[model samples]
Target chain A: NAGVTQTPKFRILKIGQSMTLQCAQDMNHNYMYWYRQDPGMGLKLIYYSVGAGITDKGEVPNGYNVSRSTTEDFPLRLELAAPSQTSVYFCASSYLATFTDTQYFGPGTRLTVL
Target chain B: GQQVMQIPQYQHVQEGEDFTTYCNSSTTLSNIQWYKQRPGGHPVFLIQLVKSGEVKKQKRLTFQFGEAKKNSSLHITATQTTDVGTYFCAGPIKGSGNTGKLIFGQGTTLQVKP
Candidate 1:
């Protein structure tokens, strides 16, 4: 399996601009998540999905939106970019929600909002 | 709300020296998991601790889950250059139930000088 994959390894956006971060998993995981990590800071969940067509807000979902159109894809959207939104974003997936389940993360996308 | 906090945001060790990082959660966890992220890379699953006061080891690394199920620790017996990366601890959000959303610690960045 290719595990989880995220598009655009790095990007720079101007204030007020918008873009979508794409993510996909070949592992057929029912659980997918989006997280952001600031420099030297721990990650904060932005949004997540339990399965195809199901999504939920997370700890830091104000500036972001997400859609799980299929079991393999969970994309994040930024409506109006802000400098505070600049950070490394990660996509992850898990086969299940059991206590023993482990998350597999994709190489993060680094965003710079100017 | 749940929060996971990690101590010693950054640690630098000489080759062959030992290093450790600690993680604490504000709420009780059914389980805790550890992940390692290399510089410019995505996070990779390390291990999961489900039982209270659990201790697991992998090669030169040791992981422990607190008896209260709200704390954990990762220790490296002999630091190696390959160990240079950030370590993170994560747990499922209480009451979320089978959704697989997690709260992650800020993370501890280990720097080993060879």
Candidate 2:
């Protein structure tokens, strides 16, 4: 089964451009998270959703937005991309809110802003 | 904001050598989780530690949580090429009601040389 799927494995955008990174999970997990990873750095949380229609900002939420319209989908939108936003973005989903179950991650989407 | 710190930003070990990475948090955590990301891959859940002074093993890897619940460690008995990757420790911050949000450490990069 495809646990988590992220579309557009790689993309390049010019400064001030906008794009949405798509993420979907088939496990019907209640918790979903968006994170970015810079070279040689740990993953930084950008946003998270506890369930459908319930979203919250995370540690690094600047220059990004997220929407959880359905339990199977949580997409990240970059309104105006900046050079600093260039990084590998990851989408993860967990079975419950306790985080006791493991988070399954997608392959990742590499975005580069110039 | 709560911070998780990981030591030895990078490590190089020869085959058959032992390796360890330490993670410390500024505040107590309900639970701690470990993940490993291979070169050019997304992070994958490895294990989780819950109880104080708890230790768990997966094959040659051993995971430990401090008695205070503010620190953790991952030790690999013998290094191999398959173990070459970045290891990250993550835990939810005590305050701010970040129930499902995890703060990740800077991560420790392990390079196993044959």
Candidate 3:
């Protein structure tokens, strides 16, 4: 199982540019999430999906969007990249919402917006 | 939004020394999980604590959940160079409109000098 995979391990974008960060999991998880980690900061959730066709905003949803059309994929969209959007982004997925539910993360994509 | 904080932003210890990090939340949590991220890597699940005052051990690492479920701790015994990384504590925030999203702490970075 490839676990979770993310594309574009590294990316550099100019202000106002747009891009889609792709995430996919072979574990067939029911939940998926997108989080950004700034240097020395915690993982700030940008968006998440409970299941196919169900998406919601998280703690830090501004400047980002997400879609969950299948059980194996959850992609994050950066509408207009800004300097503040520069950070390492991670994608994670879990089997279910149980007490023992543990999320599996991807290698993460490093983005730098100038 | 629920917030989690981890102390000792950074900790440096010589090989074979002990190290510990604490995570505190502003509100009660249903469950807490610990993850480790190696330098330039993504977060990986270590363990999850559900019961209050629960403690679990994994080889050289010990994880504990507070009696109130609002805090957690990770202690490493005789740290090694391979233990050098950032440790994070996360939980499914409980409050108005829960999204089953995990709120992560501002991880504690550990530097083990061999």
Candidate 4:
């Protein structure tokens, strides 16, 4: 069912470059999230959207922006790529108000900034 | 912002041995979810524990939620080679309808030696 799908499985960017990471899900979930995982570190929330047109910043939202124009798609934009921003990004989605349904995560995109 | 802490950042267990990981959240959570990520792979939903002192089991994996709703644990009865990976515990942050925002622990990396 392609629970959660992300684009650009891997990417290499130069300093100051900008790119968008695309995430989509077919589960018709109302909650979507963006997270990044670094070497030996736990996943850090970047942003989240409860529903279409509603977005909020999470733990580490700096240097990134997110938009939820449609319930099926939530894209993450990196304004300025830097070495510190190099990490694997993941997208996840879950049903609203259903505490029992666990989140489904995407395959993740590996980004390397030089 | 709430903080989630997981103990024993890294663990190596021989095959057929038992394994356990503990998680604690700074604030009370409505529910706690567990996820597993294999090397070079994405995180997959394992299980969710809700209600004080709740416990759930999936084969040899057992999950527990503390009575205070601020801590949880995952125990594997007998480790196997297939159990090698990083395990993460996540709890939703406090404040109005925070079910969509999750704070993940640092995660415990489990390596099973066969």
Candidate 5:
């Protein structure tokens, strides 16, 4: 099974450009999350969705937007990208709320905003 | 806002040496989880601790949660090159009213020399 799949492994965007980072999971998990990792900084939550059509803001959601149209897909949109948005973005899904529940992650998308 | 902090931002060790990383949270957590991200890779779940004073082991690695549920530790015995990565600790903030949100530590990067 392809656990989680993310498209456009790498990309470079100029300031004010916009793009979407697509993420999908085949595990049929109900909990999905979007996080960004920067050098010397831990993974910061950008957005999360508990189910289709239900999304919530995370710690650093100012420069991003997310939509959960279906249970299998949670895409992150960068509208008017800024240099601060340059980082590695990861998509994760969990089957349950238990702490022991493992979160399967996608290969991640590396975005560089100049 | 809840904050998770990790100590010793970076460590370099010989292949056979031991290494340890500590994580502290400003507030008590409902559960704590650990993850590892290899070079050029996404964060992968390692293990999780729920109960107070809980300890779990995975081969050469040991994980522990403090009695107060506000701290944790990950120790790797006789580290190898395969252990090179950034280790992160995450937990759900208690009383946040949002059970799905996770606060992550800054992470500790490990470098093992041959």
Candidate 6:
């Protein structure tokens, strides 16, 4: 399995611009998540989905949104880019709840908001 | 809100030296997991601890879960240049139920000089 994959390895966006970050998993995981990592810092969850059509806000959901239309895809959207949004974004998936499962992460997308 | 904290934000060690990093959660965790990320690379799962006072080892690495399930630690014996990277600990959000949402700790960046 390809596990989880994310598109747009790197991007630079002007203030007020909008964009979508795409992620997909071939593992058929029921849980998918979006997280952002600032330089030299831990990851902060942006959003997550337990399954298709079931999305929820995570610790740092502001300035971002997500949609899980299929078990394999969970995409993140930024309506208006901001400097604070500059970070490396990662997509991950797990077959089940983490309490009893492990997560597989994708190569992150680095975003620069200017 | 649940929070996971890691200590020593950074660690530097000479080859053959022992290295360690600690992780603590604001609330008890049902399970704790560890991941390693190479420079400019995505995180890869290392291991997970489910039972209290659990300990697991892989080659030169050792992982431990606190008896209270509120902390964990990773130790590497005879560190090598290949061990240089960031180590992160993660756990499911305290009240997120089975959504499998995770909160990652501020990672400990390990620098091994060979």
Q: Candidate 2, what DockQ?
A: 0.69
Clashing pairs in 5: none
Model 4 steric clash pairs: none
Clashes of 5: 0
Clashing pairs in 1: A42-B106
Looking at candidate 2 chain B, the ten consecutive residues that score lowest on lDDT are: B92-101
lDDT measured at residue B41 in model 5 versus the true structure, 0 to 100: 89
For residues A1-114, what per-residue lDDT tens digits would candidate 4 score against the true structure? 879999999999999999999999999999999999999889998999989999998889999999999999999999988899999999999887566667899999999999
Best by DockQ: 1
Docking class of 3: medium
Give me the overall lDDT of model 1. Answer: 0.93
Candidate 1 C-alpha lDDT tens digits along B28-108: 999999999999888898999999999999999999999999999999998999999999999988898888878889899
lDDT of 6 by residue, B1-65 (tens): 67899998999999999999999999999999999999999999999999999999999999999
Model 6 residue pairs with clashes: none
Which residues of candidate 3, in runs, are more than 4 Å off? B96-99
lDDT of 4 by residue, B1-114 (tens): 578999989999999999999999989889999999999999998988889999999999999999999999999998999999999999776774745777789899999999
How do the predictions measure up, each by TM-score? 0.97, 0.97, 0.96, 0.96, 0.96, 0.98
lDDT of 2 by residue, B28-86 (tens): 88899999999999899999999999999999999999999999999999889999999
The TM-scores of chain A alone, one per candidate, are 0.99, 0.98, 0.98, 0.97, 0.97, 0.98
> Considering only N, C-alpha and C atoms within 3 Å, which residue pairs clash in candidate 2?
none
As for TM-score, the candidate ahead, 5 or 6, is: 6
Model 6 chain B worst lDDT window (10 residues) = B93-102
By lDDT, the better pick of 4 and 5 is 4
Top candidate, metric TM-score: 6
